[model samples]
Target: MHAIIQSLCSLWQSSWQGMVMGELKYRKGSGGSGPYRVSASGRRIVRVSAVSPSGERMDLMLFPAAGFAVGGRKAEGGVYWHTFSADEVRQYSASVGDHNEIHQTESPIVSGFQIAEAMEGLEGKQDFRIRFHYPVRSGEAVSLRSEGKTVSGMTDVLCFVWEAL
Candidate 1:
């Protein structure tokens, strides 16, 4: 029974990672022909067009999570890395009213607030959206990196998208 349980747990973990950290795809070009563009303020603008649409937009002014400096520059931009512990997850859950059991398990899923907190003051919250492709497990360090105008991590998984308002 012990062996069987261990095998099952291993299998589950493997499957979970596979699903969550799936292959990530991104564009490698610099420019595009769209109604929107990466603004000078690091935000994106989606102008109304004949075949396009418009809405409240905001930009993601990214910065290093560590607040470090490089080449005399105060780390203008870098990736955001964080590892949420069980206790931290619980505290965040309680504060945000997220009582899902999925967060209380051994893996201790992370909450959106946690990510937002990590990104606080770095992104324009007025017009932004966060997508959770997978719930980060406890002690699993995840890095949110800037990909052009979007922030992605974990197999290029899109963690947050910013637009202009």
Candidate 2:
């Protein structure tokens, strides 16, 4: 995921411009495993595509962070709370090879991929769309809840919604 984001940034000739929205879709019978070849195109709205050796394809749409609203809808259903320690955040960043400065700060921001991984029952979904309203800092408490095909992560400093399609 870090490599994919870097590819997109390089294509755009920018540095951590941030994203407004993103979507991921997995092909049928394609377990969405890694070792993917990633590429990106477009300017205002970048379209990132990744293909795995096993023919699994993932398409991600990233909207630029400009003139976009930032807010989150309330999540419904059972809720679970989690707090990521600074060490945990650092470990995740190291594991993913994403040494972005923002994520290495004293109060590190949790990576979007980490947040996605924290959501339960997201596996086996054919498609899902996610919008990150704000950055979740390490040590900040986060609440997760799922209603049907939708899952949401809310924190005091950040919130995001993921809907399976």
Candidate 3:
């Protein structure tokens, strides 16, 4: 039983798939696992959509569970990178009226950042990292190095951790 249990645990952890597209992606939970179960009423929903300059849309959903902590585990803040495709970014600049060449394709790249109100001194002013689980279309992978003063001296900060596949 011990050998069987250990084997199952190993297989469970090792089974996690890295980010892939145009492939049959498994719908998973906050922690990806399988023999994935579903709710009876199908009341749960997760919506994926584009803000302005629409591109790809992917959605997976599950029922909520206990303990809704605003911030995720720090140890799980793993490898991070993001790139904004020039295509989806076009209509975005038009929407924002930031037609400055500095924000457009001629600049090669643009970046963005945010800090959670929960992450203030109450949570300790700290830096976070990111990995491009999906292709970043706009305002991405930006740190204080790129944007400066992520969460310092703010009334309320809104941070978004996109998602990890």
Candidate 4:
């Protein structure tokens, strides 16, 4: 995921300077290690897609700078909360070789990958899509709630909305 982000940013003729992940769709079955094929389009909303050796696909939408809105509806009722500590965020960033400075600040924001990793029961799920609505700062608690096909992660404002595809 980090590699893909870097590649896309390079293709955009920019760095991670102002880039943000807007949405991600992953199809998990049949993928092997990639010598993947990737493509990108759009300006305001950069759309990127990757196809792996076995035809597995991942699509991503990105916003350069603050191209997308920041806040969203709060998660309500019967939700599970997870608080990612600064240390955990740092560790995950290091483990993933994503040394983005945003994740290194005193009050850092969790990376999108970390949020997705924290979600439970994703294993063996064939496909899923997640839209990032807001950033989850370090030490902030995120509420996770599942209803039918959707799963949401929220603080006071929604951070991400997820669905099984």
Among the numbered candidates, top lDDT falls to 4
Ranking by lDDT: 4, 2, 1, 3
Model 1 residue 96 lDDT score: 52
TM-score of 4: 0.77
Give the Cα RMSD of candidate 2. 4.5
Candidate 1, residue 57: Cα displacement in angstroms equals 14
TM-score of each: 0.44, 0.66, 0.22, 0.77
The lowest-lDDT stretch of 10 consecutive residues in candidate 3 is 19-28
lDDT (Cα atoms) of all candidates against the true structure: 0.40, 0.60, 0.26, 0.70
Q: Write the per-residue lDDT of candidate 1 for residues 18-98, one digit (tens) a residue.
A: 222111111222333545332222112111111111322321222221222112211224355766799888776565544
Residues 1-165 of candidate 2 have per-residue lDDT tens digits of 344444333333344355544554444334455565778777778777766555555466656555543564453444557888888887876766655555677887776656655542444434455667666778877877677877677775337777776
- Candidate with best TM-score: 4
Expressed as tens digits, the lDDT of each residue in 39-154 for candidate 3 is 11223322111111111121222212223223432222323333355654554444433333423554322212112112222334332322212222244442221233222211
For residue 7, what is the lDDT in candidate 3?
23
User: RMSD in Å for candidate 4, one decimal?
Assistant: 3.3
Q: What stretches of model 3 exceed 4 Å from their correct place?
A: 1-77, 111-165
Ranking by TM-score: 4, 2, 1, 3
**32 Cα displacement, candidate 1 (Å):** 37
What are the candidates' C-alpha RMSDs?
16.6, 4.5, 17.6, 3.3
